[model samples]
Target: MQIRPFELERYFARHEFSAKYLLGSSDPEAMSIADLLAFEPGSEEELKRVWLGYTESLGDPALRRDIAGLYESVAPEEILVFTGAEEPIFAFMHAVLEPGDHLVVHFPGYQSHYSVAQSRGIEVSHWHGNPNRNWAPDLVELPELIRSKTRAILICTPHNPTGYLFDRSSWQQVIEIARERDLYLFCDEVYRGTEHDPADQLPHLADHYEKGISLNCLSKNCGLAGLRTGWIATKDRDIYNRLATFKDYLTICNCAPGEYLAGIAVRNMPQIFEQQRVRLVSNLNLLAEFFARHTDLFSWQRPRAGTVTFPRYLGGSALEFCDWLVAETGIMLIPGTFFDMPGEYLRFGYGRASFADALARLDAYLAG
Candidate 1:
């Protein structure tokens, strides 16, 4: 199978390590492995007992059980864990989609949501979210995008870059469409737990739709990216079996250490999420003020979820602006063009302590 480059991952590979202050990262401030191990009262002793061996290919049973508890209705066995959110997306696209199978993907999203399937010769239609309307897709447009060969409707809620969360009505509309069309619903719920109002949290797509597959990870809400543990939860046993079999060809099993740490993180998800959400809300307020102070230079709406926001730059190409900012101030912000939107926008991640400092530097640069 011919595969094209993953644009965002490639950009990270080139700059992630060397960048001094990363203001483009999507993951929240990460918790160290030690922090995760220390979550429980007697975790120190439990940590010492963790074995170093090939873990269950389906993921450690305990971790799956803990993850299952996050959803309203799903069992541990129905979840198939993968190395990261990225891997499951690839596995699903390859395992389920075929050449000429039609896919409806939410646009201005993480590129992989569409590009990877397109690379495999799938007929892809974009469900575009209008930037003018708080970066939301019209639920009414979806039915028109469906066809006889349509196999899936892929969506990312509390989306990447834009951070727009779909309301209950929107999600209900999607569920109805998928049920009526008999199409698979692939919902990337990586940012599911980060709702501004916890009540805004929606049911796992798998629980809501027979063919729905809900993708999640420890990376975003739990701030456990280094664990590299993510999973796909589906009511469809066929998909679970296919992804489980496909796992052998990719990452056969989760890393023993990553799995161990992920188990602890999952078990303590409530506390972990609480800490991170507090930080995110605090930082988002700061970001709102920062944007207000520089209204002339950037156009942004305060995001409802996620750590990052894509802001339009009124002057110059984002690449040129970002390169100049990094070179002059040692602050790194991603050029939005990397995600296929260019010239006018760059992604600013306000999830880190250095975000304010970086904004100050950019302000100084703009002034000078």
Candidate 2:
């Protein structure tokens, strides 16, 4: 089936390699393979020996087990690996949705969440997150969007761009809605582990909803985007089987080396999260100061978790500002319009150690 272009990905493709300061990236500062390998006692030799053969189609059992350990209730048997979070989302929408099925999707979201479904002729309704509420979706709007044909509720927590984390109560309310509506709950939890406080991490959706499908990856939180390893955890046996069957036509199996490195990353998640948390907290404070200094030209609601935040530009259109900033100072920032958001806002990722440097350059650019 054909699909519309993924606008954000398309924009990245053209500028990502050429850009100087990548303030638009979603992943935190990435860790080297050597750093990740150091987590295990005997990893040096094992990493050197990781073969080039095709890995298990269902993913290496040990790797799946390591991923399962992240959730309290899921087992390794229920996890199915994919190339990346993007793959599972595309596969899932194709595997589960039909032409007339209605889907409730979070708006101002990652483009693929709705675009792929829309391509299949699925009826999609947006559940909007108001900017006045720090980009949090009103659960009140959910039921009104649901129709008899509604089949799924899609969400992103520790959400992309906005970094809004749902409290446990919000999670429970959404699960209750899905349960009552008989709709599948597809929660993209790729950023779940990056909560500002470890204690604030919410339960995996698969554990809380019978038909929930939780998608995760080593990209954002683990800072192992190069691994391209992601998975889906679901309690529904039927969906699990269907996804597996559908997988055969796509990537028959994951890359063997990436699997090994990702296994190492997953096993040392505690250290990774700790390092990333410290960086995010520090950078976010710097971002706060930056925005405060330019309050008249820009406005932002500090995010609760994750690597990025979308801020409104009072000076000019986001696209115009981003283009001028990049051309003048070699600092790259994403215009919110790339995510189908209004042109006044832009996404800024401040999880990198270079965030201060980027901010300084932006300051100079804006002053000139």
Per-prediction TM-score: 0.96, 0.98
lDDT of residue 336 for candidate 2? 90
Query: How do the residues 122-215 of candidate 1 rate in per-residue lDDT, one tens digit apiece?
Result: 9889898777787889888999999999999999887887888888898998999999988899999998778777787777898888899999
Candidate 2 per-residue C-alpha lDDT over 132-160 given as tens digits, one digit per residue, 9 for 90 to 100: 89998998988999999999999999898
Candidate 1 residue-wise lDDT at 25 = 81
Model 2 CA deviation exceeding 4 Å by range: none
Return the TM-score for candidate 2, rounded to 2 decimals: 0.98
Model 1 steric clash pairs: none
Candidate 2 contains a number of clashing pairs equal to: 0
Worst 10 residues of 2 by lDDT: 10-19
Give the TM-score comparing model 1 with the true structure, all chains together.
Answer: 0.96
Please list the residue runs of candidate 1 whose C-alpha ends up more than 4 Å from where it truly belongs after superposition: none
Per-residue error (Å), model 1, residue 158 = 1.2
